[model samples]
Target: MSRRLFSCFGKASSNPNHDDKATTTADLTTEEQRRCGPVVVELFSSQGCATSSEAELLFSRLGRGDFKLDVPLILLAYHVDYWDYMGWKDPFGSSQWTVRQKAYVEALNLDTMFTPQIVVQGRAQCMGNETEEILSCVASAPRVPAPTFQATFQKPTPESLQVSFTGALRTKVDQEGVSVMVALYECGLVTNCPNGVNKDKVLANDYVVRRLEKICSVKDISAKKTLSGTVNFPLWESFNPAKCGIAVFVENSSRQIFGSQNFQLPDNI
Candidate 1:
């Protein structure tokens, strides 16, 4: 799919269900207990980059709920295709993801693009291996608005799953140009590399993005202004429902993230 955002610069581009369940807070981490607002961490990485392993592991820990932080953390791992030219081609790599990263490069005005890069809440970018810097960015991220965000999941048939998200814009940005996006992410993935810089290494990954869908664009939004959309996904034979989840976030024309929310898929279904 093309990685274009309708209201901004470009255009871009599920489901199986045996169960129907309206998600609840219990299906998600307890955000009410968190001391800070939601923080979205995007990792642009490649299996061919040796340094990406460390960052991937760190993201795995966060996804596993090992962090002691007081904020809600939403992690996403976007495997870029740039490194595939190496001996080993990353099975998860996508040129669309590479385009997404390049868009960020222009948005953030960075010196150059590199593997194992981390963008925190779309406000700061740092070397993915810089653990201390990553933590500081999360610690200082702006607080998102309260429980105004909502996500609902349902399986109307055995072959499809439908997800609907609703949330309000808690903050405003310049030009009043903003867009909402919903992403389906999978966790607890492992890949064994036979060739490339990471040859012979078994890498564990989480919050690995499987798909990203744009919801809508807002020319202007005031506090509590609602943004909502529903997306349908086909259930693939390779999908492990228990290891999946959803993430939703708002970004401005400049690609700065305003806030985000996430929820885990219930095992009962």
Candidate 2:
């Protein structure tokens, strides 16, 4: 929305801080949740990167709709493990996310992957801190058709959280080529860097991905078709449903996201 954007980090970086996780202000109206989400913003970040904090801060604004953009976004931050060797390890970093970022690198023909980068709707890519470019991507990105979802939660054991969801796809896509991705992301997180480029800094992260799973392979029937599946999220010592939410999206083998929606767990089910 402004030409005031900055250049991207080309395999090089700097440092900054982060944003608060989901807040009471992030809650949307029923109609907004019911409609097909406008975009899916995937942030590939790390606590080890100096510039990642700026990106995280920007994501927090987008997540909170601070700019009041018309686009509805489902945000997920994947803290990658590549930077751990620098000094400090991101408590949330994982090789799985590194692999995911690598796949995006290949799909988008990027020379290399870096922290504070974002993929919009699995179709557009940009530096995470490039606020203006991000907004541009959101305004022009292709979106998925509207979807419907009903979710239920069950605590079978203290260590496990079972989440079952039933939903209907409003559009058709190849069943074998795509799958539904369910991510359990948490907010209200704060970490103090012990070392690394971000040493001695306080970082606040929002929408940090805690668990990701392929709930089911997608199939589009000619008629109104319903799909249901369950994802058992391993409960951590500090797991709290209030600050966590489930984001479901359809992605093909090519890493193109078709549509996505986020749901807050109901108090009863």
What tens digits encode model 1's per-residue C-alpha lDDT throughout 175-210?
657677878888888998889988899988888898
Cα lDDT of all candidates, in order?
0.71, 0.77
Q: Please state the error at residue 61 of candidate 1 in Å.
A: 2.3
Off by over 4 Å in 2: 1-8, 11-35
Stretches > 4 Å off in candidate 1: 1-36, 65-67, 156-159, 172-175
What is the lDDT, from 0 to 100, of the residue 122 in candidate 2? Answer: 73
lDDT for each residue of candidate 2 in 1-269, tens digit (9 for 90 to 100): 12122112554221111112112113546464445455788999999888999999999989888888776889999998877777888999998998898888777766667777888777678888888888877765664565676778899998988988788766576544568888999998999887888888899999999999988985546325888899898888998888888898878775777677788976653
- Which ten-residue region of model 2 has the weakest summed lDDT? 14-23
- Evaluated against the true structure, the overall lDDT of model 1 is 0.71
